[model samples]
Target: MRRPSLNDLAAFAAVANHRSFRRAADVMGVSRSALSHAIIGLEGKLGVRLFNRTTRSLSLTQAGATLLARLDPVLQDLDRALDTLSEERGTPSGTLRINANKSGARILLANVVPRFLDLYPDVELDLVSEGRLVDIVEQGFDAGVRLLEAVPQDMVAVKFGGDVRFLAVAAPSYLEGIVPPTTPDDLQAYRCIRQRLPSGKRYRWEFAKRGAEIAVDVPGNLTLDDNDLLVQAAADGRGIAYVPEPFAEPLLKTGQLVTILDDWCPPMPGLALYFPRSRHVASPLRAFIDLLKRWDGAR
Candidate 1:
């Protein structure tokens, strides 16, 4: 059998890891049709099918699974070997892919990203922001940014920023001539702009005061996804909205919104940069982490 090229093997790995031709193509900076043709060529060379395809789903065949299991470590070792050359040259040059939630992305953009880019001009940083939590390894991300508490047990987490607080806020007009909620249960008597999570479930409002904690399945006529939208709805007097304090800070300063039950909201663990514990950290990722720590310390 003719040997397949390393590029084809890497392409196969990307598709296997992401389980989507489109996502793999995006990561590889190639067109979907081109990636598909490459895979077809690779399969012809190996004389074995690698993937099971359907209109709605994609999965690996047994041969493909076995190939991936063996290929992952080899590719990782190759990456480390190549990274060594960059390290010897006293420069980190590579693409660094990070999957981050919207809030985490905003924080990094405001603090770490700009400096990191300036310091390592050769490093291509791919930062994808989304609301859904993804398996960083399976998604082919060098690292992930998420709330510290959400980091997987097997991953190493570098906590940064600071504690976060979720606040229940409402427009002053909405509170006019009406009694504001003093306790979690009082939300039952008011309209709330409910939050829909990425998983399609309503987010339960959480509160803490002293030693007591409560989670309220808030009632609402309007349910929306995304923190910004929730904050805007509250500012428009649609209803009370529970969101991260940062999201409502601007409106609160302008008197468009006011915090209610201030004592109930307490700070919790903030965002962290997390990576697989078993993988070797590449030079680019190492430099980025160092910069992240510096920025975090300065904050």
Candidate 2:
């Protein structure tokens, strides 16, 4: 077996990533025809089709996905190493990618990121909102938000946002004539609006009563992925919503909603900023970590 050159790998990665020969060539500062020829030459050498190209769109073949899955990390490490070398001369200025849930990002905006951007205006934040667990390192994210329990054992988890608790609430009008459940068991009788997870599963409402924590896959009339929509549905008397306390607390206080199942919810882990501790931190990640730490202290 022969080893591929840097040019071959770079060409392959760029083409696979952009999924467009023209875009890859533009980014690589080469003519489209030249880039195509290089890719053709590399493919002949490797003897595998890396891409499934059509007149309008390009898609990665199975072989291409496999190679890309392996190479993306290697390229990121190289980029990070290059950045570290550059850091010897001055402050870091580059993109820092993160994947977080919607509520987590709201907390960051409310309490963390403003100060971070104020401290370093040149640094860029490419934040993605996603609820499902993602392979941050493989997905090219520098870091991600996760619950303390959800965070991997090896990653360093910094508490950026304080603990989260679930709230079960319903509108005062909705509760009219209907006696609010005095106990967790009574919740089984009520219609609920629930969060539907990415896996097409309705989120079970979790509660704590006395010393026991119970997870109930309660029945719901309306199920959706959007947390805000769930809240709206609850407000419209569609059903009770089991949502993060941060969102429902304000409404509960205002009497727009009444809280139930308080004893069932123990404070769960807060929004955690975590990344692999073993890998060398890029300057952007280091600065972001510092920002989170500082923000945590102030909170």
Candidate 3:
């Protein structure tokens, strides 16, 4: 049997980790056709099939899974060794992938991302913004940004920004004839612009004040997934929207939206950058975290 090169094994691992030729190729900065051919060549050399391909889905065969289980750690160790060399030279150079929700992404881009990029021009930052929470290790992300409360307990979290508050707001026009909600339960009589979570369930509006807590499965005819959209819908007089304070600040300042049940909403823990406790932190990620801490401190 012919021996496969390091690149071949690395390519196989990339494909196996992502389970998508396109995504793997994108991460490796190679064309899909080239990546596919490399995997084919790798399978031929190894005399075993690595992936079970279909028109709609791609999954690893048992043999492929076995190879990946062993190869992933070796590749990770190799990467750590290479990173160590770069660290010795006092320069961090590599891709740092972060999975973040939209709010967290915006905050980072506005505050931390610029300085981090400027300081380490050799490092590439791949920041993906989405609503869903993903496994950073499984998805090949260097780290993940999410609310501190939502971060997995097993991961090490770096809290930043500050406390965040969710506000229940509505357009003055919508509230003209209706009495504003004095408490969480009063929302039942009003139209709410309900938020649909990434998990495909309606988000229950949570409120707390003076040792009392409530979760309201807000009633509404319209449901939206994105925060910006929900704010817009509320501003357009559709219904009340519960959104992050930042999202509604502009409209609140302009008097387009008025806060209701203000006493019930209090500040909660803010965004955090989290990573797996077990994996070796790469130099680039370590550098990024250092910058994040400094930026948060200076703010």
Per-model clash counts, in order, read 0, 3, 0
List candidate 1 stretches off by more than 4 Å. none
TM-score for candidate 2, residues paired by index: 0.78
lDDT of 2 by residue, 1-299 (tens): 35678888898898887777876786567999998888877777788988888898888889889999998789879987888775785776777888888888888777778887877677888888888987675465778887778787888788767778878888988889988887667878998786889877777777776667677777776788887887777877887888888777667777788877667667877778889886668888888888778768876
lDDT string for model 3 (1-299, tens) is 89999999999998888888988888889999999999999999999999999999999999999999999899989988999999898899989999999999999999989999988999999999999999776677889999999999999999999999999999999999777889999899999999889999999999999989999998899999999999999999999999999999999999999999999999999999999998899999999999999989998
Where is model 2 poorest over a 10-residue stretch in terms of lDDT? Answer: 133-142
Ranking by TM-score: 1, 3, 2
State the displacement of the C-alpha of residue 184, model 1, in Å, after optimal TM-score superposition: 0.3
Model 3 pairs in collision: none
**Model 3 per-residue lDDT at 63:** 99
Cα lDDT, all candidates: 0.94, 0.80, 0.94
Query: For model 1, where is the 10-residue window of minimal lDDT?
Result: 132-141
lDDT of 2 at 168: 85
> Better model by lDDT, 2 or 3?
3
What residue pairs are clashing in model 2?
A: 207-264, 208-263, 208-264
Cα lDDT tens digits for candidate 1, 25-56: 98889999999999999999999999999999
Tell me each candidate's TM-score.
0.94, 0.78, 0.92
Q: Which candidate model has the greater TM-score, 1 or 3? A: 1
